[model samples]
Target chain A: MVALSPDLTGLRTPALRRFLTPGLVALLVLASLWSLSSGAAGLGPGQLLAALTGDGLSARDEVVLYQIRLPRLAMGIAVGAALAVSGALLQGLFRNPLADPGIVGVGAGAGLGAVLAIVLGGLLPAGVLAVTGSHLVPLAAAFGGWVTTLLLYRIATAGGQTRVTTLLLAGIALAALAGAATGVLVYLADDRQLRDLTFWGMGSLAGATWGKLAAALPLIALVLLMMPFLARALNTLALGEAQAAHMGIDVQRMKRRAILSAAAATGAAVAVSGGIGFVGIVVPHLLRQADGPDHRRLLPRAALLGAALLVLADLLSRSIVAPAELPIGIITALLGAPVFLWILLSQPSAARG
Target chain B: MLQIDDLKVTLGGRDILHGISLQVRPGEVVAICGPNGAGKSTLLRAALGEVPAQGRVTLNGQDLRQGKPQALARLRAVLPQDTQAAFPFTVAEIVAMGQDAGDFAPEPGLVRRALAEVGLDHLADASIQTLSGGERQRAHLARALAQVWQPVGPQGARWLFLDEPVASLDLGHQLFVMRLMRRYADAGGGVVAVMHDLNLTAMFADRIAFVIGGRIAACGPPDAVLDPGLLERAYGCRIAMNTAPASGPWFVPQAAQAG
Candidate 1:
């Protein structure tokens, strides 16, 4: 039967969305537990629990838990949440379902920044090197993304109106330019720098450490903190920029903040994890299909679902080749494409042709 | 009162509106009628501050140019000519957006009541994409109504500025909406609409403004402004004038229980 008043049916879906918070959190917990256990140095659930409480732990197990597995899990959750939430924000801001930070030039720009720092570190002064210490690459990557987004915004936005076509075209051109610049830097790099670049370029969760996680976490946290306030504004934005403005949303300010948040999230994630793809696109798209597209529901939920999906993917990445690892990017593209295609085909008027 | 004084707009090296001046008071419906390319929508956009224009435009004694959007929103709402939802939001969710302006709590039940007023209560749960063009227009109208739901709030008379509000609607829905406009004016709100149908304007509007080449060629009540000779000259087409309806109210939406 057709649901007769939105009073009855409209509120129901959002209520169900809110009710899903705990369930998604639980899924994240399960994924995290499974990830903490399944690896090169596999531990059972009991031992996993024992490793946590520091009760009857072996020195080697302790080393693995604190240094390897824990940091990896934390980084997976952080980067996953960051990528996913950035995807949700870009989709909302552009009012296009297909929009993603990776699809745009933001990630590519960050990648160039990481390469620049890696290849040019010798030219920096000793004092500056001392100041940057271990954070040179991630900081450069975040700054690069921020600059690219601003440049893209300048190129594609005219008089407070974003030209989606221009944005898409400019993104293609910008990504190509960044890729070329990265190539030149790769050509410039010495042997040791080439090794760092190669390992980083492959996009693995294998080398996650507390120091790398700490460098990226603060920026991602800022993006996550700014998201909730954007929820209501982004929901109204789906009605068009002018309509959103009519609803008293400060369209200019909201647009700036949204771009900033997405750039920071994408930049920080790319800096630490290299180029994990499809999490941003697939997570929000799947959630919107399962529930609805209200950004209030989509944003935080995307974070949790993204984290869980990545953790599970990472688990599969290492275990499928046990004692060796496949790049996480390959796994996501492999997994996400089929699920995304299934969703598209299942919709009754999928093409609406 | 909403005032536009000597307002002018230029776009892409062409003038759209030139020193157009008008005033709308509470408890009245004003219609702007003109042929295509006569700058009717441009005038409306200038008033809403959607396009930057020179000269003075004010609502309730506050200058629209300097007035904060949040403050302006509480006093007036606009229904754009066309809108497409970027996502699959429900009709009720679309209307609920109108319930709040910037920093105010939504008026409880306004979304339901607005949907009912628009004869869309049954389809409130439906996806906005599933709606026909006419239905979509009405859904947006319902949202516009919910924006300034109370005819007169603490800030004096609330206002709705609609652009071709009935352009996509069917005959029955058009009359229903015209009557709704009449009733809204009767309850002390003000409305300014860019109108296409002259008969509906004559039937419902308290004042009429005829735009031609970026200026008001004629302005007054329907009896004075809708002259056949003036309309014929302005439109460059032969015109006919009559009042009687050959007609039908067709559908009353009895469940809605309103005019």
Candidate 2:
């Protein structure tokens, strides 16, 4: 006996959608403003506003605002968005909530690639180095992430199904492999290069310069732009691959595009910011709990929420110890790990999925 | 008409379907039946163009492979055997996925209409992962039905290709699903299903196909294909084909020692 199930068109969270995006936007705005105002220099809101407008702003303040903070802020926004979106995309592709770039070895692969380019760029011919120039490291990192993703995908999937246990185990192996390779590069590097690598490895936004941000932004922006188009396909993918295909998705092509975009995003972010963990894993989970996992909403909202979270984390990294500065990675992990534990503990089945 | 010309499929260097060919016309329900490993599902997939095969499959004279997925989906909807939603998605959300798929203009209230058709209207707000197996099966059927809500679309005749659509349902629900397929066929759409229940297939199908060991052993009207000797050989057991009072031929497998 069928009950008269009426109008399900009401499913779209109308009240939630209306408020969530703007709420995230406002949060990002507040975080950015708060971050810009409080720092080692400690510019108050009015002074920061004055400095921003270039009204009665001193040359020292000008350099601090324009040369120092702006680039870091921009880099934080870009890297944060890229990491979170990459996590969302990877999770969708793998069809598991826990498929993060950092956990799955893709971020380590990207880091290895960046280190390789730095250490091995010296070995390349003068002409080749000239052609690659500033772009070499980030490009190599993206390629490395792409290759690692392909390898993991190949190992974990058979007969159009992915075994989660295999994926996690292979990720552990691949992460070790990448770490070993990175260690070898560190051993080969000279003192100056070694110092750079050490600081970079800790994952700081302090190295955020206009030139470096420029190098990473194009790739990050490209993938962010690609996410909206992927939303429908990713939603369909939540229902297994064959079922997604039956729903008229070009499943194989969608898989390739998702991997490629995720790789590019993660590689670009890691190359510039150095192994920032948990924003990718944390931001999406928070949003999913906030509403639900509809990628159309999730992807864009992820961009805003991720940017806000990272900017706040960056603020804490710089401020918590006052001027000496902690690595942004530390702040993210410290904040992210406990939340992640809560998620794992609360819904063991959803986590397993 | 949906036509299959000598369809053959091989997977992992082994043959799964061997030169199978069949024709299905609009306005009729056809069932593909066989024991386990008989390639019944494979044949259905081949016709749906879900698997690679070395033959021609044409629906309404258009090569199934030539059409883009969007184009093909506009003409037919398939309900796969089992699909897991990786995320927690509500029933209404799942049904709406099909109702407005690929940006097609949905018929007014078709998603609710579909949920009602399957008696899932009461649980429209419930998550799909929370439903029972039969409930999930009917939910998917509703999604498939919503996708091609109109039996006749601008593409002429839309179709429903169901793989064990009622395999998880109770007897009453099984009969309900079969009747739903029959009604779709009668309304000028085609229905091709891989079925497990021979009695239900006999009752609902205009034509029945018996696949045995990657080949079609018999395919004809229910009475013709429901032969005792053929069923026994195809299924490797004793089968009793009995004539009910006023219905088509139906059969039940006899015990190994009973003869």
TM-score of each: 0.91, 0.93
Off by over 4 Å in 2: A1-13, A52-54, A125-131, A338-353, B106-108, B256-259
| Candidate 2 residue A236 C-alpha distance from true site, Å | 1.3
Candidate number achieving the greatest lDDT relative to the actual structure = 2
Docking level of model 2 = acceptable
DockQ of each: 0.46, 0.48
lDDT of 2 by residue, B1-259 (tens): 8998899999999999999989999998999999999999999887777788899989887777556777777788889897778776778778877775633454667778999989899988777766888999999899888888889877788888999999999999998899899999999999999999999999999998899989999999988888888877777889888888776777878887343
Residue pairs in clash, model 1: none
Per-residue CA lDDT of model 2 for A77-135, tens digit only, reads 99999999998898888877767898889999999999998888789899988987787
Task: Report the Cα lDDT for residue A10, model 2.
Answer: 39
Which structure among the candidates has the greatest TM-score?
2
Residue B27 alpha-carbon offset, candidate 2, angstroms: 1.2
